[model samples]
Target: MSQFVIIGGGVIGLMTTLQLADAGHEVTVVERGECGRESSWAGGGIVSPLYPWRYSTPVSRLASWSEGAYPELAFRLLEETGIDPEYRQKGLLYLRVDDEARALEWARAVGKPLSRVGPEEIYSREPQACPGVEEALWMPTLGSIRNPRLMQALRARLEAMPSVSIVEHCEVKGLVGDRQRVSSVETSRGNLAADQVVICGGAWSARLLELAGLQLPVRPVKGQMLLFKARPGLVNRVVLMDGRYVIPRADGRVLAGSTLEEAGFDKQTDDQARESLKASACAIIPALADYEIEHHWAGLRPGSPDGVPFIGRAPGWDNLFVNAGHYRNGLVLAPASTHLLVDLLLERSPIIDPEPYALEGRVGHTA
Candidate 1:
């Protein structure tokens, strides 16, 4: 069995490790901070893409595959670890609170079922919905997952795997190798050798590559989100309006988020962004105005210029790979991405094309 070392302990890293370990590979995950507490934990856990049909064919394919995988993965983890990821298929309502014409047109183009729901119908669907919510486009197949619980369950299962080792607080300093390939990783604790190294550092991917004398075209796009304490059934469906979303969890907490900022590595939650999110959320569901703000936080999404993630091997480095730059769709794309990586490592057929996500052409040079 191949010995693999994965960097970053977020969902992608953890999920990839789980898959590899399950396949009988010896896996070690090195995390700088608390495991599974970075962007993965901070994410809103929407299992579906914001607009799946609008994305590229590869992206849509990956999203669809991952969506199908969620149920089985959630069930397995819950059965083994006794932790519910709160996987729910409550559907999603995309409303045009301000510009109905454009929203309706876009919804029609995307083949989403459009409905002209009056105040009464809206209230019937969600009694706590705002008074002004006129009409919405509904996609009933979309779903969500409780990201933290999912991470916890995956962590527990990984801990049970004798082939998987999780080393937290072990900051990776750089890659240890020559220009052709990576032999191992240099971490704060010391050097650890591996047969293969996959970097899943998320927003910090660029910095991590720089340490290895490689330039990657990855940047951090900051997103700020807010949390509210409210009953779950109050909003049974996820609501998207005016570039903001309201997600109701099984627990008595409603998540209203988020603002996309092109800030570099800044995890601070700006007051203005938080206030704007609150305003937009209240505009969609007026009762949110009465709910106390329980938490406000931010995460940096790894973004690329073409809105596509970088996966597969980095140029000039054999067995050194990348699975980052997922941007906003990291959670929804995790399963498919991990599957593709495993297939690539195992020399099996990949589900998606590796060209667009290849690290070589974009980064130009190799480490």
Candidate 2:
């Protein structure tokens, strides 16, 4: 069995480690901080991208597969660790902001259920959240999971595996290898030998790959969000207006987010962003204005130029692979990305065409 060292302990890294360990490979996760505390934990947990039509075809395919896999994954995690990821099919309520025709066409092409909604229908469906809407599109099969719970369950499940282990608070400094392969990775603790290494460092992926003499176009896109404490069923489902969204949890913690700012790894949450998100949330659902702002934070999404994640072997280094640059949809794309990366590692047939996600030119591709 190959010894695999995964850099980054976010959802992507943990899920990939699970796949490797289940395949009977010795896996070790090297995390800079506490596991699952990065972009994966800070996301809204939407199982599908906000506007599926605007993304690339490769992203839609990965989201399609992940939409189906989430239910089973949640069930398995609950059964094994007694922790529910709270995978709920709350559906998506898209307000009339953009052209619905493109969305309808994309939904038809994807074989996903889409229906037009009138103002009355919108009010009837989400009276508290979406009071008045001229037009809307309802994707009833869309779902979400609580990301924090999902991460906890994943980390617990991985810790239970004898073949899987974790090393937290240890940052990877660089890599020491030759032209043929990467023999080991240099961490803050020490150098660890590895048969293969996978970089799932999310927003920090590009910097990590620089050690291998490859410069990925991946960069940090700061997203600031706000959390509100409301009563249960206040914000019934996921509500999207313009570019912002409000995700209502089972416990009534309404997550209102976010702004896509190219701030170059700035992780601070300012009052400007917080107030803007609150205004947007209140505009979408009037009741959200009354709730107290429970939390405000920011996360750096691994932004790619074309909004598709890179999941393939790195150029020049045969033993190094990358599964990063997922941007805001990493939560939705995690499962399929893991499958494709593991397939590439094992030299098996990929679930989807790897050309679109390949690191060929590094300009358009996500890797």
Candidate 3:
């Protein structure tokens, strides 16, 4: 069995460690901060991409497989760790679908149910959340998870695994060894020996890979979100209009978000963003204005070129792999991305085509 050291303890890294440890490999997760508190915890946890029919092939493939796998994964984590992920099939309500033809065609091809709902029907489901909508598109199978709880459950589950060791507050500094293989991972605490290393450092992936002389085009895209303390059933399902969305939890709390800004690692929530999000949420759900804005926060999503994540062996390195640059889809794409990485690592049949995610044409080692 290979000894694996995974840098970063975000959802992507945690999932990778879980699969490898389950396969009887010795795994150590080297985290810069507390595990499971980054983008994974801060995301809205939509199971599918914002619009599955519109994304690239690589993203859709990962999201498609993961959308099916989540229910089982949630149940398993709850049973094992006694932490509920709160995975719920609340469906998705799109107030405006620009290309109806393409959505319907893609829905038919995927064998998933997509239906048109009039203003009356839309109001019936999300009576207060949607306003002045003539028509809408509804996907009943779409689901969401309480991502913070999901993170907690995964961390708990990983801690119980005998083959897994998680080193929180330990920052990975560099890669040590020849170009043929990575002998160890240099970190803030010390160096850890490894047979193989996987970098799941999210937005910070590019910097980590830079230490190994490769240029990965992963950077931070900041997103800010707000939460409203409302009664249960205020907003039903997930509602999206324009580029923002409102996710209603089972307990009546409502969440509204976010802005995609190339802010370059800035995670501070600003008043402008908060006001903008509040206005948008109030517009979607008038009742939100009545309730108090309970909280506001921000997270950095690992942005990549063309919204496609790099998830394969690093060029010029024999033992290093990457599963970062997922942008806002990290929560939706975690299961499938990690599965594909582990499959390639084990020389097993990949869940999907691995070539699309290969790191071949991009900038290779420069430093």
Highest-lDDT candidate: 2
Rank the candidate models, highest TM-score first: 3, 2, 1
* Global fold similarity of model 2 (TM-score): 0.97
What lDDT tens digits, residue by residue, belong to model 3 across residues 70-170? 99999999999999999999799987779888988899987879989898888888888555789999999999999999999999999999999999999
lDDT of 1 by residue, 1-367 (tens): 9999999999999999998988889999999998888889888999977755556766766787898899999999999999999999878877765555654575567565555566666666677776666666666678899999999999999999999999999999888888877888999999989999999998888888786567888899988989988776767878887678999998769898888998788898878998899898888788878788999999888887766788898777788888988888889999999899888988888987877777776784443
lDDT for 199 (candidate 1): 90
**Candidate 1 segments whose C-alpha is farther than 4 A from its true place:** 97-121
- In TM-score terms, candidate 1 sits at 0.93
> What's the TM-score of each model vs. the native?
0.93, 0.97, 0.98
Give each prediction's root-mean-square deviation over alpha carbons: 2.4, 2.0, 1.1
* Deviation from native of the Cα of residue 193 in model 2, angstroms: 1.1
Q: Which ten residues in a row have the lowest lDDT in candidate 1?
A: 97-106
Leading candidate by TM-score? 3
